[model samples]
Target: MTAPDRFSFNQATAKYWPIPELVAGCVEAGVGQLGLWREETNAYGLDKTAELVRDAGLAVTSLCRGGFFNTPDWYDENRRAIDEAAVLGAPVLVLVSGGLPEGSRDLDAARAHVGEAIGALVPHARAAGVRLAIEPLHPMFCSDRCVVASLGQALDLAAPYPADVVGVVVDTYHLWWDDQVWAQIARAGREDRIACFQVADWITPLPEGVLLGRGLPGEGCVELRRFRDAVEAAGYTGPIEVEVFHAGLWARPGTEILARTLAGYLAHVD
Candidate 1:
């Protein structure tokens, strides 16, 4: 079956897929949308990757990241990320707020810093025509990766900015366990803060890193269709990016992975 109109394949799902091959495979599979990560694009030469995807008629739904507020150079780093998003025509730059600063256990302070950092970058992001999307990773990542661990907090952080300037991502992989997520999703819609929507299922026996433990759309227990319906009901009619990150999935051929992703998305999400 053909992918849904809103379906977007995040390149990370096929982590090992080279840019050229990934683009070719997407074209062959009739996939028209993609989500990109910085490392891969930077390695392939941003401009070259941009040109390749543009020429192939694939639209970039969002760029993987631009946040890590705990870092000393966050301001400059995020500005560069905004520039790159503009270069690639991605409307949104996903921000993964960094964990607590070394030796600091103040969660409140860390989250507060995330808001301030976004406020600082708003002007640049606005000038570049890119929206800053705050992504709240699972609380498990709180100490070392992302401290903003809930959609409620993400919305709170975005409350100070214009809805167009700052928004939040609704990723099932990280948010499915929250009972308040439904309410938060509605609030996000009413507030116009839902910038990007992604899907991945939660599986047991997480891998060593935990970062790569995500399962494809239906492989785990998430209510994929329910989340899809929630976002749609909340008035978000943007791309629905499948962003699973598992080593086993990545080991498959790019086209094969894309096919499986499409199947899972169709069966469980669309």
Candidate 2:
């Protein structure tokens, strides 16, 4: 089968690759799209990175984050994120709903707050013409990283808003273990709530914090192609972002990482 038309290499997969090299490497590897993070884009100066990607004739598929509603400055922060996404020509701004607030154990409240938080940002996001994509991190990250833990939950949070402004992210690495994901993908398709589709393999013997233990496609147990098929079946015709986050993978040279990423996608996902 041919590779997906919207294949994108998320920069987080090659965490330490310098911005210029990452851009050059993607171009050399025939990658036409990218998923960028706030930190990396900031480090490179958002405008400069925007210019670089534009000059390379690459599309900024999605920006990695604009959530964490539990924080004090979430509203302003997310507005800035939306504006930045607009400037970078990214259509979606992925939101990682943060975990419980400090010393708080109210999971229900945390989730509710996320919905309200996204609701508040909808106006700005719509004004900027940038969609806010809520990403459901693995439930393993429930306590510290993200509270929204399933595709269904993410879709629920997005249900109240206009489909163009709020949506959910379907990352295979995080939702692969959930049996209900197929149904949720169907629901997402029916509702037009799928904003981004990310891919990564699930590997075992996780690291100390368990934040960066991911594998390239075909290196682990998860069925990458199945997830790809499900997303497309869900009526998602947008970019397919490869977002593996392995420390070992990150240590490699940027070009090697890009080449391997392309090969992995071809072998396991295409």
Candidate 3:
């Protein structure tokens, strides 16, 4: 089956694919969009990478991150992230709210700080024409990665800002286990807070850290299509990005990964 028009290959899915080759692979495979990561872009020369994708006629669906409120340089770093998103012509900048501060177990304070941090960046994000998309990772990551674990909490953090400026990311891999997810998705649509939609399956016996343990579409247990339908039903008509992070998948050639991603997307997510 052919990939749907909205299918976008997130760079993290092929973690080691060189930027130029990844762009070329997407072009050859008929994929029109991509989700880029900051580290790769910065290493490749942000301007050069932007030029490469643009010249190749590819659109950047979103940029993988700008938030980590617990850091000392968060404000400045996020401002730069906004600038990078603008340069890449990416409308959304996904924000992974960093875990609690050192020696701090105050979940309330951490999440609260995230809200305030986003508030401070709104002006810059808006000026740069980038939407800050708050991403809620799984609960297992709460103390070390993202404190925001549920879509409801993400929406709450986004509620104080204009939907067009600050929104939330709906990543199936991080959210598939929540029973209230369906309702939260609808609420996100009604509030116009669904800025980005990502798809990935959940695998058992996750490797240590669970950061690189994600499975590709149709590889594990997530109801990929159910999520697609939920997001679409909530009025999200943007690109459907397949963003899996597995060591095994990343070891393959970029072209092969893209082919498999497309196949799985068509079979399970599209």
Query: What is the C-alpha lDDT profile of model 2 across 55-101, one tens digit per residue?
Result: 99999999988999989999999999999999999999999999899
> By lDDT, who's the top model here?
1
lDDT of 2 at 247: 84
Clashes of each: 0, 0, 0
For 55-108, candidate 3 gives per-residue lDDT tens digits of: 999999999888889999999999999999999999999999999999998999
Rank by lDDT (best first): 1, 3, 2
Clashing pairs in 1: none
RMSD of 1: 0.7
Candidate 2 ranges beyond 4 A from true positions: 1-4
Tens-digit lDDT string for candidate 1 (1-270): 677889999999999999999999998888999999999999999999999999999999999888988989999999999999999999999999999999999999999999999999999999999999999999999999999999999999999999999999999999999999999999999999999999999998888889999999889999999999999999999999999989988889998999999999988988
Question: Which stretches in model 3 have alpha-carbon errors above 4 Å?
Answer: none
lDDT of 3: 0.94
Computed on alpha carbons, the lDDT of every model, listed in order, comes to 0.95, 0.91, 0.94
Q: Which stretches of candidate 1 lie over 4 Å from their true place?
A: none
